[model samples]
Target: MNINDIPNKSFKTVYKGIDEMEVREYLKEIKQHIEELEKEKESLQKIIDEKNENLNNFKSVETSISEAIMVAQKAGEETKRSAEKESERIINQARLHSETMINDAMMKSQHIAMQTEEIKKQSKVFRARYKKLIEAQLDLLSTNDWEELLEYDKDINVEAQSKVDNIVNNDDNVNN
Candidate 1:
């Protein structure tokens, strides 16, 4: 339904007999839903932040582990070498997973941004088209032909009577 179909605030008092409490309750429900969505958005933001922090931590750990491995190899300790290699491998895998999570988060953010932009563009196009249509309608209504048509009705009736009189006169002459 169009916006106009909804009554203005001043006219809404006509339904005073109806329990406005229900309307209030429904509005409260909508507000609650909006709040819930906002909370969900906040939670998603926290998840993204945590993922980014974890990714950074994993990268640091990977660097430190690589350096430790180099030191162990230089010292030529087989046991230390095996432990360092295992730690490096684990750190590398964690870093890879964290990077994937960060990439996914970035992709989701970009997708949302693109969708929002597209919606804004569509709204702008709709507004332009609506304005053009309204202006065209106004132009049509403002034309001289519409005014002339309004003025022509009276003149048309007079002209019709005159034609009838002439037809009658011609019939009388033919009868004579």
Candidate 2:
């Protein structure tokens, strides 16, 4: 039998034989106590195991959450970088377009200025030629040719008046 099933018979018997019934009863009660303790131990061990499992699950969930946060942060950083790059590209393209427009405007301005200069030179030459033509006409009109023509017309009128006077005189003599 197990040690708990037996009674403690350490002392010697005194005259009558030792009563085993009381000892058996006591040993039985002690065995029952030991069995109760074992059951309590098992119950406590199960609770501890359950609690440990819960703690492990909690740790796993915490790790997963941490990893998720890291991934989200990385994605956010990538988005920010991509946006910055795209903005820079757009700005550079705008700058190039504006520069091209400015360059075109400058070239057109230079062409217009050159055209204006050429027009000015052409106008200057035209004015000089026109002035020279007007001066030549004035010189032609100022010559003695117009005066001689006027004198010739006066002489013709005087000769016609004298012929009329002679005719009138001859008529008067015929009438007398």
Candidate 3:
């Protein structure tokens, strides 16, 4: 029977009533049973202690895991912040560069416009000068100098005839 069944025990009495020796023997057995229960209680307490230790270890591991998760989250937030700052810096740099390029292009456009205006002014001056030169040429060609030119041509014709006469006279002499 179970050790817990000791409390419900009932002993049968002898004819003269309960035997003193049997009572003593029953007391001895009950004492041994109490000792055995004490040993079992100690053993159960040791098992309980071991289980408590394991539970504490589990709690510690859980705490460590929680701390690790927190650290990782903090690191991720820090990385995100760094990336955002870097992106902002890059966007600002690109904006500045684009503005510089636009300004440079505007300056070049203004310079080109000024140069074009100067070229137009130069073209007008050249056309004016060329027009005056052509008009002077046209005026000279339309002049009344043709009479003087005809007289000069007559003098050239007379000189050429005289040379021809001299050549004929020399040939006649040579033949004689």
Candidate 4:
């Protein structure tokens, strides 16, 4: 029977049977022992319940940490990919910019070269014209006309001076 039935157990009275008072006393002791054991069991159960709750808490923390780590890893990978793309884009942009700069520089250099060639041609034309003008002046100086003018009478002829001025002016106009 269960511990609760211990006190209610009955025994038939007979000649020289066991003492009732002694039996009652022994039953009382047994009941007290059972009560103490139940109290101890209850205390142990409470400790077990607390330990289970703590274990569950630890498990939940572990799960949360794991999730956080996963999220962090994903974020790191995404950031790395984005950075690589950005760097590649920057490099491409720089390449295009450099190419454009080089092309512009080449075009400018070609224009400058053409300008220099034109200047050289103009300089050659100026030199040739200057040479012809100088030759004409030398030919005029070597003519006998100047000697005739020098031999003329000391009293200068106004008409002859006017003719000389007209000839000089005509030469200047032709040279220009």
TM-score, candidate number 4: 0.65
Query: Which residue ranges in model 1 land beyond 4 Å of their true spot?
Result: 1-87, 149-176
lDDT string, candidate 3, 56-162, tens digits: 99999999999999999999999999999999999999999999999999999999999999999999999999999999999988887876788889988999899
lDDT of 4 by residue, 37-118 (tens): 9999999999999999999999999999999999999999999999999999999999999999999999999999999999
The stretch of ten residues in a row with the least summed lDDT in candidate 2 is 3-12
- Model 2 alpha-carbon miss at residue 126, Å: 2.1
Alpha carbon deviation, residue 139, candidate 4 (Å): 3.3
lDDT digits (tens) for residues 5-92 of candidate 2:
3465344667887686776787778878888988899999999999999999999999999999999999999999999999999999
Clashes of each: 0, 0, 0, 0
Error of 1 at 88 (Å): 4.0
In model 4, the worst 10-residue window by lDDT is 150-159
lDDT of each: 0.84, 0.89, 0.90, 0.92
Please list the Cα RMSD from the true structure of every candidate, rounded to 1 decimal place: 55.4, 6.7, 6.2, 10.3
lDDT of 1 by residue, 51-124 (tens): 99999999999999999988877777877788899999999999999999999999999999999999999999
Better of 1 and 3 by TM-score: 3
The candidate maximizing lDDT is: 4
* Residue pairs with backbone overlap in model 2: none
